[model samples]
Target: MRSKIEQIRMSKKNTADSGIDIIESPEALASQISRAEIFFIKYKKALIGVAIAIVAIVLAFAAYRFYIDSQESTAQSALSNVVYAMENDSLSQALNGSGGNEGLLAIADNYPGTDASNLAHLYAGIALIKQGKFDDAIDHLKSFSSSDLLVQGRAYALTGDAYMEKNQPEEAISYYKKAADYKSNEFFTPVYLMKLGIAQEKAKQPKDAIASYGKIIEEYPLSAEVTNAKKYKGLLEGEVGE
Candidate 1:
């Protein structure tokens, strides 16, 4: 029923339509990859440099940490003799080198970044405080840091004590407040509050002093500071009324 020429024309049309999908243009594909290839070639050296810098920084940090750990171990070993001297009340020997052994000062100096060095600062500062060398005590105490709430608060309080010894009531009041508020535990809080109240009284702030004492009575009644707090508060109240 169909003509031969008409069937041949139909076959040719079908073949032409399918050919468009079957074939891809080489120019279009090359254009897509050209930008990416150029970018990588242009920045290759800089990329490698950045990678090397990053690795160096990481390795340097690891080495620094390893050095600090080693120093801490050495410092701890050196500090044991100083502790024994301190316990025996050889305060001078605890600060300086005792006999052939290293003291707190030497340990702190030799191992500056270690935890044991920081601890040595605390002990040396307290020993200086015992010797009535308030300025030296403050210097060492200021250099000290601690994660323990009790010890850190005590350091703050002792710094306040140094200020008090210098008759600097305003400065003393500030540090006493820091100690009282640092961690707010049952033991040191009441004691620090007592010191704060005394400092407030010296600063001629009877109202503030009384309030500080009242905290001891209310919050830490079981503490030894409670008795002194009551006594001081009553005395101050009587004076304020007058």
Candidate 2:
């Protein structure tokens, strides 16, 4: 009897160590099921409310996304209709609309928070520049934003041009530097660097202007700006030496 009792204890110990739970009787199993049912009954209302809340939140987010997508689509369509005026060089019509078609300025104003609205700002700024509205061009260009490095750089360069036209060499230098350094490439960077060098020269920063031109000669030798860069750099270096 003593040996049998020891063996039973040892079996229980091994089962516990192995994490193998054994239900001793049907009554115990039934009791556990009953307790689980009781737990469900006690929290049924709260559990249902939580599930409903999760579903409502998901639906609300989906509806909001759909609304935003619809608004963007409408704005893009409006932009497509009006961009022909810009292409045709009808500056006034492009900014103020012709007939029933909306203009770039109108699209920009009406479709706030849309990609098309941002592009409208760019178009309007360019039109303003062509019309000799330098201050207005700067304002619209400042409002325009882009993720594309090339386009954004071009906008910066254009802003520099506006400032230069206004005889603000310091402001022109700042924007030209941004255009030159923004994801610099051989093709466009040389152009921007040339602009920067000119602005720096006008600002009486001969050394800085020479360095800007030197970058074009050394880094973008194949660019069209290379010839001009060399000429400018030589002139500035001679001036500094004198």
On TM-score, the leading prediction is 1
lDDT of each residue in 84-105, candidate 2, tens digit only: 8888998899898878888888
Q: Where does candidate 1 have its weakest 10-residue lDDT segment?
A: 17-26
For candidate 1, lDDT tens digit of each residue in 14-74? 7885565344656556665787788978999998899999999999999999999998888
Weakest lDDT window of 10 consecutive positions for candidate 2? 17-26
TM-score of each: 0.83, 0.77
Which sections of candidate 2 miss by over 4 Å?
Answer: 1-61
Residue pairs in collision within model 1:
none
User: Please, what's the RMSD in Å of model 2?
Assistant: 5.2
The residue pairs found clashing in candidate 2 are none
